[model samples]
Every structure is written in C-alpha cells, then in structure tokens.
Target: MAKHPSLQTSKHQRFWKNRRVFLTGHTGFKGAWLSLWLISVGAKVTGYALKAPTEPNLFELLELRKDMISIVADIRDLGRLKAEMKKAKPDIVIHMAAQPIVRRSYKNPPETYETNVMGTVNLFEAVRACKSVRVVLNITTDKVYENKEIDKAYKESESLGGYDPYSASKACSEIVTASYRHSFFNPNEYGKHKVAVASARAGNVIGGGDWASDRLVPDCVRAVLRGKKIEIRNPGATRPWQYVLDPLNGYLLLCERLYKNGAKFAGAWNIGPDLKDCKSVGWIARKFCDYWGSSKTCSIQKGKHPHEAHFLKLDNLKAKKQLGWYPKWDINEALSKVVEWTKAYESGLGVREISEKQIRDFEGFPQLNDAELY
Candidate 1:
C-alpha cells in the first residue's frame, strides 16, 4: 500500500472513545468503515443490517462482524429493528441504512421507499422509545436537494426535492426525521435527553471496498482491474467528490455536538468537500487512472445512460463555521488512499489489517502505526 500522509488530530477520535454506538446498515461500504473506525477507538458498536450486498463489499472483506454485534436484520422490519435497538440500548444512533442506489431504485421503487422512508421512520420511533439513546444522526444524500442544473453549491436551508426514486426516498427520509423531531421530541414535551436528532447530508463519496454498481470510483476500479474500458453514463456530470472518511468524520463530530449540547444542535447539516474539488465524472476517472498506474480510458455510453443531473455541489461553510469541521484530504490524496487500500486487499492481504491500517493512518494513532500489530 502507498504511504498516506499523516492527518491532524481530529476531535472525532477523542469524543467517540468508549461510547455505545448503534450503527444501522453496518453491512454497507460506508457503514462498515464507520464501524471499524468506531471499534478502533474502543467504542462498543452494535450493527443491524442485512448481509453484505455483494460478496466483495467492505462489510465482509473487513470482517466487521468480528468487532461488532452483527445482527442480520432489515430496517423495514420494525419489530426486528426495535428489538435489536432495545437490546443494544446505545447512547448514540446513526441511521445509514437505505436503498442507496439510483439505478437500483428504478428497478425496485417500492423497496427503495419502504427501506429509505419507512425504515427511517421506524428507526426514529425506536430511538424515541430507547431511554438510553441521547443523540441520533440520520445520514442522507446530497441528491436530496432540488437540482436546477445550476453551478451554485447547495446549503442546508435549501428545499428538499428529488427527481429520482432513490433521491426522493432520501428526501422523504429527511422529512420523516424532521417530523419526529418536531412532533415527538418537541422541546415543550420532551426534554433534551428525550431525543436529539440531526440529519446529515453528504456529497458523493468515493473510496476502496465499494463494489456497488452505478458508482464512478467502484466502476472504474472494477473495470481497470479487469482490463476493460469503463463506460461513463454521464461523463460531464459534476459532483462534490470526497473520501468516505471525510463525511464520516463530520458525522462523528455532529454526534459529539448533539451528545454534549442536545437540542441546541438539532437540525440538518451538510458535510461535503470544498466546492473547488467538485469535478466531472471524466476528470475523476482520469485522475484515478493516473494514481493507480492504469492506462484505462472511459467512454461516454451512447444510449444506455439514464437521465442524471449534470451538476451538483455543496456549500460546507455551515459545517466549517458551526461544527468546526473541514475535509482533511484533497481529491487527489483521497483517490490515492482509496486506490492503495484496494490494491493491498486484492494482493491477498488480510482485510481486517487493511481496515485497521486505514483507521490508524487517518486518526494518526501511534499504537497502530505498524501493520504487523494487527
């Protein structure tokens, strides 16, 4: 694996240590990374989700089940999810389980809505019933914003709208979260500890261990590894691309704030990269090839591509000023680290070691500096 530059001390590490965290969708790519990171910091984590979506997904590859109380359950199953939540009795809850893909949403709209909207509602209901739960962080997508093909970065105050099934479902999830916060956890009826909820909207995340279809980085990595040219559905599509860890840090920071301040910090927040890093799909593909030493090229698919937004970006000034959070890695460095991790995993290295190495590298934890320690 290529050497990753040292990261500065993040408040996320210090705040999360020894915390009891319930993470939904622990079997997904981003959720697996978050679970591993939480475990690395000595947090007790209980994960509730289905099996890994794909065989090579980060959930199975990293063996997160070993560190977490992995419960094979679906978010749509209210009884099962509530039972697990009640048993875990976690202090903090992060709801990331959702129908996360746009193309797949087209194939199964009902499943997408059931999982994304009603699943979120059910999770919030469970959080309300759990007396031990103090802070809840709901993860939504940047696509929740109503796009008009404009160049301006989206702010948290922007209207929630979506044209696609996946995006609309997330938007609906946000609505559900807000409704619960107002109706159930109102300051008048329920005290701060009664429940604090914050919705987090993040930009397009790219990283290693994501074997999902219809994503830029994963598609490119899979294609390059198999010596095939990547088919770019929308080559000119612009997105705010950041490393997976970038938003994960923001999520943790938000959780810390909610834990400490309770209702004072309850609201929607955007955790995205700097606006300047927003680049087109083609630009990101070329950069990936350069870093991975692959000459693979991407061609715009003539007719198979579905309708997608041409431009999307986020204004993270709210997070920077309010939460004091900023992305530590640029697009180039983020892509480099992702490629390095995948290369190492593909070389027959232990997945647990690879996962721990990333956490150690990002947190600058001295004890895990040596890979042999894992």
Candidate 2:
C-alpha cells in the first residue's frame, strides 16, 4: 500500500484498520493488488503463495515484502500451511491461489484438481485448527457456472458445473467451501466455532500489474509493446469484463459485513460489471487498441483454439441488493486505464506510484459511460 492521496481514506477504514489477513496467491496479479490495497487501508497482511507465475510481477514492483510477511510456499502442503496459519493467527483469510489459466488446465487436468480442490481442503483443515481466523473468503471464478451458450446471466444459486478442467476444479472448490461451512463451521453452532466462510465469484478482472499469459489484457499489452498485431480468439464470445478493483472492493465490503454480522453475510457471491458492459472480445480489443494509439487492427486467429464460453455474464443483482456493490468503472474506462498503465510502464515511471494513483482514481469515482462497448 504505497501512499497516494486518493487511497488515504476508505469508507470501511474503521473495520480493517488493524486487522490481520492471511492472503494466499499474493505474488500473482490480483493477489498483489489486494495486498497493496489492504496495506493502504491499514491492514496487516501475510502473503502465502508459490513463486510468482510471471517474471516481472507486481509483488516485486511494489516491494510488498516491506509491508507483508511474504512466505514462499505451496498451498497444497497442508502441514506447512497449518503451521503458518497458527503462527500468523490472522483475523481473516482470503484464498486466491490456484492454477487459473484454462489452457494450462487442459494441458494438466490433474495438477489443476490437485491445486484447486485438494488445496481448498488443505485450507479448511488449517482453518479448523487456527481459531484466530473469523472470516474466510475463497475467491473462485465466473466460470464455475454451467454455460448454456445463451445471453442469460448466471446467479449464485444456479447449478454449479464446469466445461473445462480449470472451471471444474473451481466448481469443486466452491463445493468444498460449502461442505466445510455446513459440516464444521455451521452458523447454527456459532457458539462452538466462531468462523464464517464464504466464496466470491468475479468477472474478467482487468487492471494494472498483470503480466500473465493467455489473458486478454496482458496479451493486448504485449502485442502493443512488441509492435505486433493484436490477436483475437473467439471474437464473438462475450464476457463480463471489469476492472480488478471492483471485485476487490466487493470482497472487502463482504468481509466487513461478515465481521459484524456473521451467518447472514456468509454465502456465495457474484462481483461482476453491469450487464451492458458485457461485450465481445473483438469489442474489447478494438477499444484497447484505440486507447493504446495502435492503428493496427486485431487479427482474428484462425483454426481451432480451446473451447470457451460463447456467452458469459454474471447476475450481480445479489451483490448489488445485498452488499450494495456496483462497478465504478465500465468497460471502456477499464480499457483506458489499461492503456494508461502500459504507457506509464513504457515511460519508466515508478509503477508503485502509478498503481497507487489508479487506486485513488477509482476511489474518486470518475465519470464513466454506461453504454455497451460494442
């Protein structure tokens, strides 16, 4: 949490000011952003995850080791995770580590299940032992829903199914979270164990400090940097694209509500952009190129690629009506921020400073259009 003028104050400041958080996958894109935001909000964070998936990472860029107790370990190692949990005695736990790439999951299904499913079990086992933790938010993906290839948005109560190995593993993760809640941490038996657990499903989160492969935003950044024509796969497929911080805000708010009111806030949630912003990949690439000052149009990749959802959106009415969560930035604005970040990176600006400023900008709630990007 590098200091910026805008991140100086948060609405939930009183709740998270001194809370201790045990965060998994802090080395990755969303993890790094969440860790920084927590620090900015005056929270103590202990990051537990494997070595960063990418070379140039946000964790190193922001020097997060100074703010958090960065631990390099595997989530699959239950003994090690339990020891760390006991040592840290965190007040809250956010599980974000997983084999997140769909293509990679296809390449190695066993690894995905081992890391996503068994790894979830290992986390709950650790939670069972460490009573210091009161709230646990397991971060899953929008792909947990069974895609019917229609324009209909999926709700939290919808049937849980997955088309790909990655999606299936995450669906399993959700099931594991539910089982732990019903079996061990039942709210009716709140007197026995005072822990509340919930799972969060988010749309396509785009933000700064992401340099992963097979992701649309990072792919666009790399193409622009290398002067290559942006490549588009399944251009007609639509997705619920949103800025990363939007979902992060939902997660934090949910944690705050759960801390004060236990069982009522504990359940599955969806943090997605407005329905109008759910646009096709071609629209995203086109908007991104316009923002990045690239005249080169997107070149649609020919031939068969891995199967992906032709239409995917999330019914965020639950989070909106329940948690009062809404996306501050829309799709076009999200793409513009991505361009701004890339420009800053190319100009050799201190990314820590720029990232902090972006967080502040979102906090300021700058004006953005509600129209569909298409």
Candidate 3:
C-alpha cells in the first residue's frame, strides 16, 4: 500500500485536530484502532465501553487507557452512558459498541440483542439530547443486508435483513439509526444543530492486536503461534476482506462529509475492498500461513458449525463517488502487515511501537518522533 500523502493540506486533518469526540466501544478491536488513530490526530476522545473481553485483547495490549478518558461501562447502562456523553459534550459521536460476531450470537442471542439493538437505541437517545453533538456515525456490519446468495454486491438501498442474531441486531440498529435521524435530527425539521446521523457498513476486517474468538485471522495467528492446526468453519465462504484501517478511514471520511454538508451525505455508505479482492476462508488461511511461514494447516471444522453467509461483498461506489474514499491497501499488503505485527510482537518486540509503526505506514505519516509515542 502506498502512503496516503500527508493530510496536512486536507480538511480532514484540521477537522480531526483537537476535536472533542465521544467513542463508545473503544475497548474492542476496531475501536482500539480508531481511538489510537484519533489520538494521533490530536482528537480529545472519551471512550465508553466495558473492559477488554479477553485477557490479551488489543485494548489492553496497546495500553489504550492512557491516551483517552476511558470510561469502563456497558452501553446498555443508559444512565451512565447518558451522563458521560453529557459531561463530555462531544462535537461528534461514533457508536461502535456491540456484540460483533455471528456464531457467538447464536450461542448468546439475548445478550447480542441487548447490546447490539438496545445499546444502539440508548446511544442514539443520548445523542439526541446532547445538543453539542453536530454529527454522528453509527457503525454497522455488511451482514445487515438481507442475503440471497446472489453474486452481486449489495447496495445501500437493498432491503435490510439478517438471518443470524448478530446480523439481525445490526440491521435493527440500522433501522434505529435511520429512525432517529429522520424522527429527531432531520434537517428539514430540526436543522443542522440537531445532529446529522449516518450509518456505515464495513467489510471483514483483519489486522494485528485482534484476538477475538471465532474470527479467521486471529484463529490462524493463534494456531500458528501455538503450532496447532487451525479450524476453518466455512472454508468456501467468500468475504470482502480489507485491513481494519481501510474502513476506519472511510468512517472518518463519512463523518467529515456529514459534518461539512448535513443531509447531502447523510445516509448509509459501504466500506469494503473491490470484488476481485474478496477471497474464501481457505484461501485466506493459506495466505496467512505462507506469510507467517508457520507449518499450520486449516481443515473444515467437524460436526455442526453455525450458519454463515457463503458469499458477501459490498458495492462501495456511493462512498467513492460521494466522499472520494477508496481502499488504500490491497489484500496481500493487508495480510502481510497483519503478519508482520503479530510476528514482531510474538518475538518480544515492543508491541506499542510496532502498532504505531503500522498506523504511520497506513496513513502515510512520517515515522513518529520519540516524543510522539513509544
């Protein structure tokens, strides 16, 4: 991936610099990355989420608690979340806190609905009351779309449906976002200060520091590191895979556009790699093993595995034409970078330094000075 020329000239830099933002779920994999990136750009971020789920999750590994006002609370706790947002009085809000898994959802359907659906509702209610918030972005998943096993990529206008609890919860969250946007923050009624809302659907993201269970990349990494054969649930399932930062960049870009032009860009946008980059689980595992040079092998899990979509992809034309957003890294580079970070950290190198280096590489920023971050 080529460096994204310095944002020094783009309004994205100035817009993000020193901005007061409320970020829920900063303890999760993608949230940790977003929090770190926001801090790097000088955003004053207040993170609200429960403690890391796993012992060695990215949030704890990177020590993200030091950089922001880390609020260790569940999003379902409306009173606590509301008070935090009120006190923070953020200029923007990004809701990412949720139960983000498919098979896990089947295992714990009620918990998934409570977090993904009710949690989103609570966040939107809080945002509605927080007058200081000018723009909001609710992060959903590509699974929010109703899948029919068609070969074509899904567009934003497609019907919203999900066969699994996790996907359905996210689809419900999307509805809640749209309902709140139109019912509460509609520019035609409440005007711009009411807070513009946009939802983003991202692809299957893989990167370092993600140790979540039931995920392909993390499972591969763990098995490789442990000299165990990785288990593949759906080897033939094809997904639009991209580096975690790719969709994150799109989210930031979406926020910028919504902040600048209220209703013009206020809607759902898809963030994913091109269709050709989409690959099967077996293919991804082989590539990861090749990059790590670990002799780990992957075989389809025996017995029952939860149902997952066989093929899924997102059409990103809307975001590209409207927000001028495009994926920076291809699959090869994305996987290589992930392996690079995992290997470096596993080798007893400074994890934080390696993470920051990858971040700099992704954003095209110059290597950080010693004083910036270690």
Candidate 4:
C-alpha cells in the first residue's frame, strides 16, 4: 500500500488564504463539506446552486448561508450563471452541480442529460467569459467509464461509455469539458489564456449530512434512526467506497496544482479509495449496522430494479504519483466516522462543532492550534 500524505495546516492556509472560489452545487452533501472547508481555510467563497434538495440538509444543518454568498438558482439558467460568475470573479471554479442519482436518472433521463450535459456547457461558457478564473475543475463520477464488470480497475485512460442515463450523462459532461478545454482553454495557449481545465472522477462517496434518497449509506442511516430494517436492494453490487473528505482533499490539492501548473495538470483524474476498500452493498450495510449498534438491523429487499454496474473500481495511481494524494481512511474508518457524525446528529449535539472537529482531525490539526486557525 502507498503511504498516505500528511496535510500540514500551514500548507493549506498558505495556499487558500484570500483565494476567491466560485463553487456550484454548494447546497448538496459534498458541496456543503467543500464549502465549509474552504471557509475554514480563509477562501472567499460564492456558492451558486438551487435550494437544498432535502428538507434536513447539511447546508442548513451547518448554517452555511450566513458565512458566504449563497445564490439559489438553476444551472441551466445561463444568463443568471454568467452574471453570478462575473460578479464573483473567482480565482478558482469547482463545478459540482448535477443530478447525482443513478436510479433517479432512469425515471427522468431528459432532466439528467439537460443538467449534467448542458449544465457543464453553461459552466464552461461562463468560465470562458470570466478572465479572473485560473482553474476550473468539473466533478464527474467514476461510472463515466464503460463497465465490463471485470476484476480490473478503471484508469484515467479507460474508454468513456455509460450504460445508464445517469452514467451516460456524466460521460457527456466529460466530453463537454474536454471540448471546452481544447477549443477554448487550449494547453498550448496557456500563457495567453491563463486558465487550466480538468475533470475529476470519484467513487461512491459516503458521509453524514446526506439525506438523499436511493443511496445505501443514507438509507442505512435513515433506517437505523427510525427503528426500521435497512433494506438492501442489491447486496452483491460492488463499488469503490470512499469517505467524503478523501476526495474533497483531493479536489483542493488538484485545484492548487491546476492553478500553479496550468496546462500540465489540465486533464482527467481519478480520486478514489484503495482497491481493498471496494466492497459490496451488503457488506457496507452490515458494517454500518454494526457501527450504529442498530436493533432493527438490515434485511434484503426483493424486487426488480434499474440496471446498475455490479462491480466498479477506480485506479488512483495518477493522483498518487503526480498529486501526492491517497485515501487517508479505509472502509472501516470511513464507516466509523459516518456513525460518529450520525450519532451526534441523533444526540442533538452541535453538528458544526463535530464537523469542524472532524475536519481538523482529518487534516491532523492539533487542539492547541484551533484558536489560531479558526
């Protein structure tokens, strides 16, 4: 196993200090976490996205609106998007807004493509018009690759294809990003353009403050909390499970690289867990039950469901070798953290405190330095 890299507080503060960041999908699970991290590190953030998708969402749980500029709008609204980006004049842009559910795509393919594909186009168009932007990272999924269900892990060089609408839409988004990168933000003209463009494909991300439906971890959390049996739809489905901070950390590092190196780091990259962390849905649910000490427990659900890839894994060698990024928490640790966060929520403890503590812990910041950093 490759050794995990240590994140120095000075290194983070030095890079992120006074940096202007324009983040989309800031109301979602991963986006909210990134937003908080950015704010903690002294980055000036302007979050543009629709209202929280769920009633009890992290954005509200953390009370994130008061700290940063929050804009509630649609990604397809090009005019609105352009105006917001122009006003923000961000040094870095992280595009994460999308219809993120796989099963939901089957019910609404048109909406999926419209948001995932056209939304990306609109973001790049806005980026093209904005001169202050130095780096733009589009967040896609590991399912963007064509899955053969083999034992082999997918690499950055893997062929792009998708069986389901959600996956296919993300694949389209990847193509759109590449088109804009080549046609507008060309690497050869980096000196003139002064912009870096890249895409990140991450694995199945599980964390607290995620109340989204049709996901395994959230389902487990909901079930355990409600004293209901956690239903397992596809027990054998295997995926590259990763803690939320693992890839968010990778995003911060990638953005830093793209900002400094420009064209050299402008391309597709995979930010995922080690191969051993990829496990089946049933395995995750069982482990989650164990950690939560759930009395209701889990039960397999029998029904025909939409087609999903049975086995999916990502090869993180490029990120490891070039970016010095590797997964810090394994599957067990990730689940334990989820349990911790969920239990804190159940106990009515201040989530922001626990969240910030977890963030500090994840970054290896000492207790004595809290006064200095925050």
Best by TM-score: 2
- For residues 1-374, what per-residue lDDT tens digits would candidate 2 score against the true structure? 44434665876567888899999999999999999889888898999999999989888988888888999999999999999999999999999999999999999999999999999999999999997999999999999998888899999999999999999999999999999999998988876788888999999999887999998889888898999998989889999999888899889999988777888888999998889889999989988988887796789889989898899999998888888777888898888998888799889999888888888888788533334223
Rank by TM-score, descending?
Answer: 2, 4, 3, 1
**Top candidate (lDDT):** 4
Q: Which stretches of candidate 2 lie above 4 Å from their native place?
A: 1-6, 366-374
**Candidates' lDDT values, in order?**
0.84, 0.90, 0.86, 0.90
Per-residue lDDT of 191-300 in model 3, one digit per residue for the tens? 64557789999999999999898999999988988889988988999999999988998888888888888878888889888787899999999999889887677877
- In model 3, what are the clashing residue pairs, if there are any? none
**Candidate 1 deviant stretches above 4 angstroms:** 1-13, 187-193, 365-374
> How badly does each model clash, as a count of residue pairs?
0, 0, 0, 0
TM accuracy, model 2? 0.96
Give me the runs in candidate 3 sitting further than 4 Å from their true place.
1-12, 190-192, 365-374
What's the CA error at residue 106 for candidate 1, in Å?
A: 1.0
Model 4 lDDT per residue over 83-188, tens place: 9999999999999999999999999999999999999999998998888999999999999999998987999998999999999999999999999999999999
The TM-score, computed over Cα atoms with residue i paired to residue i, of candidate 1 is 0.92
TM-score between model 4 and native = 0.95
Tell me the deviation in Å of residue 63 in model 2: 1.1
